[model samples]
Target: MSSLVPPAPAPALPALLTTVLPALESLTTALGIPRTVLASDEEIEYAWKDLPRELREIPAPLRGELVARMCVAVSTGLFDSAMNYIWNAAILQLRAKIRNFGVPIVAQILQSDFEERNLVELQDSRLLELSLKLNIVNEDGFFFLDQCRDVRNNFSAAHPTIGTINDREFTTFLNRCVRYALADASSPRGVDIGAFISAVKGARFNSSQNDVWVQRLSETHDAQRQMLIIMVHGIYCDPNTSEPSRLNALDICGALNSGFTASLRSELVHKHSEYAAKGDEPRHTASLQFFERLGLLINLNESEQHAIFYRAIERLWTVHNGMNNFYSEPPFAERLLELSKQSAIPETIQDQFVQVVMCCVIGNGYGVCRAAVSSYEQLIRSFSPREVALMIGLAATPATTLSRRISSHLSCSQRFKQSLTLIDPASVPSSVRATYDYYTR
Candidate 1:
């Protein structure tokens, strides 16, 4: 939005200067944003002048709003406050001067949004500073977490282009881009800090409280409230904390129940196994990534020394919790079997496995192919021809095309046939058959 609402002009230059000087002086203090990192007003003026001729005359009203927005954005930054204030002011000035600057402005706006988002995320890292202390209140404030979830949605809406990306597409794109970042050991730690923040926000915790968490993290480090600082920062900074923070708080609360942590950990493992039993690759990949990150943090030499030992324990807990369901849910159980086979031999190359799996899931056919065939067999045994045809159509082509694409580009063997055999015919519902048939033909 805007910086200062322009002071109404007086009759003459000297008259205006005499009356307005103190207000300008007071404005600086009232806004509380300083010129510490701000460029000279002349530089901001020059930046405005250098823009396209159409953008030269930004309306006074719009300029004021833009400045206000920048002021709010700046207060959070130490070095960045002034720089961003000037930079955002420049961008907003340019934006205000246009009729249809959508395409031209998209790049700048998107970039600004990203920077702001990342900054907020960086702030969130010290969440203990931002998180509200759970005092003994009359009501459970679950709404706080709900608010955070809403903010996450807002961020997603602001960047809908990214939202359009499917899981596999995103993974592929990330792997490619992150390769350079990961390889460049000489790169600054700040880059990784930015990257790590982006990754966390992108994956978990959607809400305005999340925004609060980030804001507070950056603004305060109160000596009197050390636990608040550590708790928020620990969760936000820790690479393994994927679940929602509200849930995390609830879990921590249950720790007062003595055996709750063990019970919760067991429940977590059962949930993971359920995902595996049902052939949910997305959840599977998430589990693998979670453990892998933990494993890396823990000692690599000793089997029991992983920093993320609890995550692995949780994974195991899920397996044991659903032992009975494992038999009844044959396809689901087989998913674990498959995961166990694929992940049997852990290596130092975590990224490689992630990339390979990502490649296997995206575009035209690769990931769904195996699942489709297995579902198809299950369909044939239990459903009518029309239903089978529908499902065949739905699942078949994409799988085949994915198979062909990967086989051509990456030389990886396709597994659609194997995946098909694993599905139980009784699980193939009739409407699903129509979807299968449409694609199969």
Candidate 2:
């Protein structure tokens, strides 16, 4: 919950190094070993002087036994050994973060059965990847920690040394380990996914139950919350889900809707599109309904939007041409109007959308659908500039159904002119201004 504050420098570090360095030199001399085999005296002193500042960067909770050993190794000019110890400390900190983030939740996110054994066996690189995926580490942390992992593998005593690192290189390595992995203060509490799912599926949540779950979701870390949102969406879109469960999902998602970030929205869209791509018709239809229920239809891609508008127009057109057409048309017309209010009609479908709505408004040789006139007027008044252009240009295309009707039926032609009057002059594109003027004139 809180970041560890840096403690004062270890009082014994300078004196301990002063004693250890001479004895190490004497032993090396007695053994007839080259002094160059270890860090030079100047290098050791430079590293030792800089070590305190870097040590202060490590959180107090992170300066464990391994970190103490790393400081001792550094004092003796065993930079490689120091690297190994510090890297161990960093790795341990990352593992602890994963454990605290809840292993089962991690398993859910990975879509695999990850456990303590799996956590323990993860290679350094994979651990970093998981950390990034779970938002345990930000991108910068992942980059630097991955580099540190490579350093531990190649340069540290953990593996055969590829090359010697300078005092500066060692300090840089220590700093990255401390700054990226060791210094992170957040202790993200994991949600109990088992209990969460059971509750969601068990019953319709009352207001109090809803508030509690919402609070729990709000309290979890971003990665876990994001996953839970997606899961809830799946439940909502599942055709076999009980009605109460569906409403439960909706209540939760709707409450949290305002807090949805772009990343969250993108994930939902990806899942929705996945259903369509796999030809999962039931889930796809339910997904579309989900979006519509949440009023998130605007987040769908252009092609999806075009399909939605196209289907809606087709339904309205059918009702307009059927028995009891006037009464039946209003609801379909009103639904289409609601959809247009949700987002701009995709340009790919705009011409068709305009043609159908205008045709419905002008009606057949019998009469206009008076009961649906309000819905039709509302749709017309809300048309975008491109739609306005399409509407005006329909008069020029006499071969089209609306233009044909406008020419043949006096009432249809007059109603078409009244529809033109509903369009705002500002929304008429300049390219269609002449056509608009010709129709109105």
Task: List TM-score per model, in order.
Answer: 0.19, 0.68
Model 2, residue 44: what's the lDDT?
86
Which candidate number has the best TM-score? 2
**Model 2 bad stretches (over 4 Å):** 1-38, 45-76, 104-147, 153-163, 211-230, 254-280, 295-303, 314-338, 341-343, 355-382, 395-427, 438-441
Model 2 deviation from the true structure expressed as Cα RMSD, one decimal place: 6.3
Write candidate 2's Cα lDDT for 1-441 as tens digits: 999986766434555456877888898999999988888888888988888787776777777899989988988899999999998898898899889888988887777899999999999899999988878888999998888888888998988888989899999999999888887756576778878888889888999999998888877778788888899999987888999998888888888888988999999999998998999999999889888778888999898888888889999988888898967888899889889888999999889899999999989899978988998899999898888888888867878988899889999989998999898898889998888888788
Candidate 2 is scored at a TM of: 0.68
| Candidate 1 global CA lDDT score | 0.33
> What's the distance in Å from true for residue 420, model 1?
13
lDDT of 1 by residue, 19-91 (tens): 4334444666678976433433333333223322212233344335544443332222211232223333432
The stretch of ten residues in a row with the least summed lDDT in candidate 2 is 9-18
